[model samples]
Target: MTTTEIAPAPAAAPARAAHLYQLDLYRVITFALVILMHVLGATTFPQDVVSDALETPLHLTREAFFALTTFVLVFSYRSRPPRPMAFWRRRVPLVAVPYVVWSVLYWGYSLLTAEQPVGSVAAALRALGIEIANGTAWYHLYFLLVTLQVYLLFPVLMKLVRTLERRPWLVLGISGAVQIAVTCFLSYPPEGVEYSTVSRFFTTLLPYQFYSVLGAVAAVHFEAVQAWVRRHRWFVAGGLVVTLAVAETGYFVSVHNGLWPELASDAFRPYLVPWCVAAIAGLFLVGTRWAEAGRRGGRVVSWAVDRSFAIFLTHPLALALLRPLIAFVGDGVGAPWTTVVVYPATVALTLVIVEVLRRLPWSKALTGRPPLELKRAAATAAA
Candidate 1:
């Protein structure tokens, strides 16, 4: 009599997953920053005093891109069924073809221009198998190699992350501790710790691997991060401001006072941890809430997002065309403002070129396709 028939309260509608457009816009913005960093990095601005002052933020910008890459990869792969072989098959061609093409281009250029006895074709082949001493383009290829390593390890890492996500505070505490330890260890080197390629690889790869794994783990608890970001946007902003201020202050104090030579030279590394966190938080906030706020962002964002992969692949050739101008402009003119102008110009020009090439008859193969016509023919034959 007290309760006629107490019905259970209806479950709340499942929270709608955020739109992909938001992530897409974030990707475009981050990639544009990556392009800017590369363009400026290739110039001489980083070594100058005023430029160094400006370049701290730019350095953060680039590391933020790398951090975003790790973050996005985690988000993209989480809960997606594992496809290890498919992953390799897709990424290998994307990475290997461009790498080989660029390697040869650089090798040929070196042979034509260098003063020393350059390696023969046979030697070049051997070097490529084990090392890439003469391949300037190989600098960027290292990330591809590292990304492949991360992909290979992802399934195992994902399992661990799933287990950890249930106790997010525990996961964060452990990861943060490990990251701090690694950073501290890296901050100081023993006398015999040579700075050769092998040593450098081990040092850099170890820390980067930790961050990448942390990113994968974080993906599992992204909802928690999203919630925190929403509630503490100002706190996040304050964290960023504090991080940048400390970084900039350290840079100037070191440059002027000539204290902590190693620390000063390696200021970029300290900023990495803070900047990565801030960028991820910033992107999450914008992506979840503000992605569609601006009118100009809609079509432009869509275009940039669609073209990002292709543009990343082909933009180096465009940069090569501009290298002569960059060289002529000299170190004096390679300021942040110069880069602010040139980097976007280069990206725009590259996008235009790629668009034009897409319209050509044989453009498909050059751009990693068999051709639209060939695809149709294959479909018909299969049917």
Candidate 2:
């Protein structure tokens, strides 16, 4: 749900500024929304219109992440450019290790939970292979795989960034148009539309290329961009509202056309591109505002940021594990109302899981973060 990206330096900050408290807030909020997306998804399991309607907007989560990740990566690269291999060497493992670990774990989990159990070890192993290859070991694992693809393309993206830097608005217009076409193919494929190795295409960098490029461009012009966004704060707010309205209306229109709720709530809708742009910009403005207000991330936000990826990895399992409890809440509380209880409980349980996992000796392998050093933590506490 996040990346190992450091925030790009702002014009007002020193070029080598190590942390952007704003980005920490941004990342933490992004991760929480991802959890909330899953929560609503689980609550609306198989599908419900109301939650589906909510999902229509929460769909911005992945695009926001892709953009933020690129912004950070490009900013860091610009600070001290790394050789392609070195960059990959340092960064890929952060995401890659977790992908492998989670894929196998979720494969086993699926076997355990399978109604039609995968009884044969060989068959199960084959399925695991397919799952990992397809980035479907679990739905969430695809993010890591897509990240790998982005990394593979990072070098090219850098070149593209430089080229776009000279023609910012023009490049954005072209890229945005391309993304809209890609979104149409993904979100509203014509009846009987098909393509080769389609599963791979479905998850390919093609879908997210626009967002990634936007991030790089933003990093390239961090100051000018921030200035522009801040200057248009009201317009950003209004645009988000209007786009969300249009998108929500589009969702119901799809439903009206007899699409299933899940299909109607598809994340890649043609209408979502503008909304995602507005939402990400809106979030950035807010993040900057928080920074302006002197709200450093502090210990609480830092702690969450450190374990955010693990929280992303573990939250779904928490939800799956809490199914019976959720069902009880749903049955007792009724439709849409159940979310009030489920979301916080899921987040609490997730952080609890993350806390336990962070203490493990191989926490980074599982969490894409450094392992907790409790003794050092205690000494620091004493200080």
Candidate 3:
């Protein structure tokens, strides 16, 4: 989720310069949430497993993590102020490089194994083109693309943020309206209309603007937000749960009644804006409390947090290779048990591989972690 390189806070603001453990905790938890959602999806068996009823809610709730990631990005950008070009110079390479590398890797894998559906080289190239265009090189890469869009607009966004810094509620209201409108468009696209690649890029970020704006608002008033979080922790928690319940119930009833069946199960709908916003707020507060509770379980959390981006990139490949094993376990075990076993096993195995990659030479370009040797080599070269 830490996609970009942030400039350090100025020396005069040492207090603000220190790392925010709550945000770190948020990153780690969001990573798990995303992984869990994907695991549940990929580990499904052919049988009557958990009902669509349960899956709908889980999917809806999990999307809050997407907002969590965006929140981290804009939050970092605001705290670590840099010129527009300087920001892009440092930030874009970290993500853009990995995106291209992973895209090529996945595409080549598909070509060599004939895994993807493409009849000819032209078809394969076309598919890759679309994938890159839409930033769908992998299921997770779409985040980086949408983030890139947000980053490109960060200057403009900051202008708005500054203009409305004194009026955060107003900012939130505007963001909520934009998010709702965008979600509605996504959930119910006009009939007989086909979206182009360029449109896809813009549409992808439209629904997420609210979260970025919210994060910007939080950044401008970090102390105030944290203080508010501490004072109203219970209220935030209740709002999160209530909104989630309402949103899930709305989906459940819609699906059951066969009303808007196509949009009923979708997470990106107007109804989820409140739920996702509340969930992000509540999670941030809860994460702050967990971080304050001391360094217990710190190593494991740190390990997971450090390798989270790598895990996101490589996990789908791990799942693909392990599908047979996953299916075997499911067939041997029962419905829910299979999900339990697959989730941890997938995470553990993926982390092990990512750890190995972390130690290898030139792995940073792929995994986003600059290994010790690479850092030393760079230092030596610079000297």
Candidate 4:
């Protein structure tokens, strides 16, 4: 008798479920920072010492959000087998729906308010090239487009990273070198060549590709990094202090030397290296320590985390509504603490609005699901 041995089935893929509490807190903090950055961008404070000091923190804030995006995306999806259809189902609507809606809304507003002639549909089509000229909208939406590309490439990227998981330091070295090379190239601003849309997309995204790939690598070796952070918390903290000081000094020197004109245009790529690394280190150090803190005072963080995404999508609208109030405070009629008061108030108001919207019937598609209502309905069905 000949006996044939059968190989056991490959182990089932890990569940995709993520801890809501942890993600929600991250979302809250990052989205709040996004809104605060936008608010700062809109306002024109006196260019004095106080304004410079206040603006420094805001400069670092949104970089934290970008780095957090990489961190969360990597961790949440690392174990799950790739499902391109499912991935697009979740991400595309979240991004494209908002993009289309906001684009039309802003376009209509511009038509109504601006002195430029409202053109025919054909003329508007022609002007599509220049639609982004004003820079009022999140010029940063290009990042979302880059993120979509990264998601599409995740499976291949993840496989490659997993193969090198045993040599994480090598992966880090390669990624860091690529990132520095890309930054150096981008910093030299191409001369005499008109940047086409395709060129522009590649130019903007090349830097972030490094982070996204590094993040996947980091995910496979997360335990190692977490341990390192815990063991070297002070070192990580010192690195952050030094990085921030250098970035601020760079900003001042650029301003003094009239390089502000060159740097004023927001190019996300170059800044990603230093600012993002600092933000990631700081966040990792904090997260590891917080996890070790045994869940005490976790609720506050959880609340912020839960409301983060909705706030990100809806806070622009909220800020538009609050613009007049912001102007009122900044106009010197209010107390010296106007900025301090208005900033927190803006976040609280946006959170309240997001919470309310998350419960509405029409809003469910946008805000994921209504947790309490769904739970009650399920209970009723069971009963």
Candidate 5:
């Protein structure tokens, strides 16, 4: 669906920076939520040690948060439209460098942990190629891969956004329908059928096209959406609650029937789209109130948000290293309580580690943080 009509792009003015802090709050909260989801995930793998009622809802929240990343990306891009090639030159390196570095790190970790065996250099390279291609080097790295894919076609996405500006519902409707089809087709497969290659590609970018496109439309029309959300704040909040209930119910029913044991746990399930959209809108409205709190609130919130991407890259490692401690706590608190404790502990530990990593030479290439002064000095010396 193409439209020749273009609506005026919204200005991301500097004076309204505080208003944008709501987005930062969303980022920080969602980053923590993702870590929590992964923590809960540990219960189901290799052994089904603990099952919690919170799992489906938390898992869905993590997937829903993908919209925040795209929203921020497109919002920043429209604020300062870059030359297409220049955009790639500047942004691709930020993701690619870290992706390669972390892939190597996770591969080496796998070898040390006996998950992968030592092999010839050529074999190791080949294995690494597969891991990077499938975003299997680590659990969370797929987000980087997906974002990179989206970045490659970002210009075209913006163009589509421009075309649909006058008819925003058309944008959401098309992307939403495709997302639903993709989600259901992928989630409810025939028994014992394999689609490894297709699954990997789906994991990358296509399933999330709706979120990215809708995010761009939201970015250009932020004020209008924000105003509508405020007027219907209670309705938005209720919608989120209702959708989450439906999703959780559907997931439990599927598991009880033994159809696809945890099929609905997959992030892209058709039921999750409504939940994601509602949750984001509800949270955005709540976050704006927090943004208006005070200067200290702003600093504290922004500080955490600034480190979120870095935290995302480093959190899995944090989770791995903390497993022994988690096991100890789990013995006493039980697995569910362990998850509750694990989420914040991991977040705190990851941020501390990331702070140190950010100060090290050339470490942004791994942590996804902006290079600090030490890195700058190292670069100057190398030059």
Candidate 6:
């Protein structure tokens, strides 16, 4: 489903001294959307047209997160190149430990919640092994495994970025076309098509190779990219509105034409590619505008950004714990609209979980962050 290609080599351009507050805004906003998507998926009536449409658009957040990770990476590494070994030693554990930790955490939860008992300990252990390899310990945990792949390949990706400095759009054009082809295949797989499971293809960057390169290439072109996004902000806004309507219309039409609800709402379809592009542009613009307008989020956004990893890791737990209490309230709103009540409650509880985890000694291993330093907090307060 993916085509991996490299651009020709050339010397790199020096990175500009761009402010990062915009990316901070961009990343954290996308993180919030991930939570919302999860809550909706867990709570909403899947067959409902309205709810199903929402899922299609929201699925872009996963790709957006991948782009942002590489965007930040390319910019940083370009500014200050990394020794591959040191970069891996430092970065891999950050994602790997949390990934393993949460995979076990969720796998265990699934076991305990299952109505049918596991026949034996060996079977359970084997299941866990398969779950981790398949990245199905939890649906969302695949992002971590895929991201770990991104981090591992970033050195190579960064070199690719440098090589394409002389022909920025060439790399983007190649990646974008590859992505479209991939989407087309996913949307219309050949009859009797099969995907590998033991080493699931989706758990790698193959499914999202375009997005992996998108962020990196964007970072390579950050100064120009930022200037262009900021300049065409209104265009970005208009494109988002237009693309969203088209995506929705296409989904309804597909359903009317006898497509299954699953295919009609599958986020990987070509109908939403432009929609995803526009939404990403709009998100980047808003983040950039916030930064340009004095970056007022201050501690609140920073705090949220700080805990986002933990929230990403543990929000399902928070949601699970709160479901019994919220499930009844959802009945009043009706299942199709249940997300209205459930999403906020899940977010609040997730925050509480993140706060508790932040206080632990091994916070970084569990949460991808260390304990907040009093001096830094004091400084933020003072500033």
The residue-level lDDT of candidate 1 at 180 comes to: 65
lDDT of 3 by residue, 100-157 (tens): 8888788776677675565877878888998887777666677777767766777676
Q: State which candidate has the highest TM-score.
A: 2
Evaluated at residue 340, the lDDT of candidate 4 is: 67
Candidate with better TM-score, 1 vs 2 = 2
What local distance difference test score does each model get? Answer: 0.58, 0.82, 0.69, 0.57, 0.72, 0.79
TM-score of each: 0.77, 0.91, 0.85, 0.78, 0.87, 0.90
lDDT of 5 by residue, 139-249 (tens): 888888887887888877666656656888877888888888877778866667577744765656777777777777787777687778768988988998899888777
In order of listing, the candidates' clash counts read 0, 0, 0, 3, 0, 0
Model 6: residues with Cα > 4 Å off, grouped in runs: 1-19, 195-199, 373-383
Task: Report the lDDT tens digits of candidate 4 across residue range 88-178.
Answer: 6876676555544455555565566568778798876555444433223444444445555565665566567566567777877887788
**Candidate 3 RMSD to the correct structure:** 5.6
- In candidate 4, how many Å is residue 58 off? 4.1
Best of the two (5, 6) by lDDT: 6
| Residue pairs in collision within model 5 | none
- lDDT value, residue 346 of candidate 3: 83
What clash pairs does model 1 have?
A: none
* Candidate 6 structure, TM-score to reference: 0.90
Q: Which stretches of candidate 1 lie over 4 Å from their true place?
A: 1-19, 61-70, 73-77, 90-92, 109-117, 132-136, 197-199, 202-205, 257-268, 292-296, 331-337, 356-383
Q: Candidate 2 — which residues are off by over 4 angstroms? A: 1-17, 194-199, 376-383
Q: Candidate 5: minimum summed lDDT over ten consecutive residues — where?
A: 1-10
